[model samples]
Target: MSEHAAVDQEASNARRGRGASGGAAARRAARSGGGPGTQLTYIKRKINVYEVLDEEGLALIE
Candidate 1:
């Protein structure tokens, strides 16, 4: 194989390896809530909610 072809193959393999491992690591981080020391804080709403349904409409659904 040519030097260029070999380099391309190596890069492709590296990308494939990174993608496989990165996916599992990403899932783990997501499940772990970004590891220890990360505080879960409530995000305050910037905009007020627009109430579309009235009390009667809500009561009928309930």
Candidate 2:
């Protein structure tokens, strides 16, 4: 092959390599909860208290 053709072929091969591996890498990242630069947020709420009555006329607070 001519030098130019050889170079073009190598570039094409590289792009194919990256395309295949890139998808695998992306899938792995997604399965593992994404990759770097991924952020997660959580919301916190207060617990409520309640009162309960028993059959013996006793009150219980929880």
All candidates: TM-score: 0.27, 0.27
What does the lDDT come to for candidate 2? 0.72
Q: Over the stretch 1-62, how does candidate 1's per-residue lDDT look in tens digits? A: 69999999989988786565567778889888885875789998899889999999999999
Q: lDDT of each structure? A: 0.84, 0.72
The TM-score, computed over Cα atoms with residue i paired to residue i, of candidate 1 is 0.27
List ranges where model 1 is wrong by over 4 Å. Answer: 18-62
What clash pairs does model 2 have? none
RMSD of each: 11.9, 7.5
Residues forming the 10-long window of minimal summed lDDT in candidate 2: 53-62
**Where does candidate 1 have its weakest 10-residue lDDT segment?**
16-25
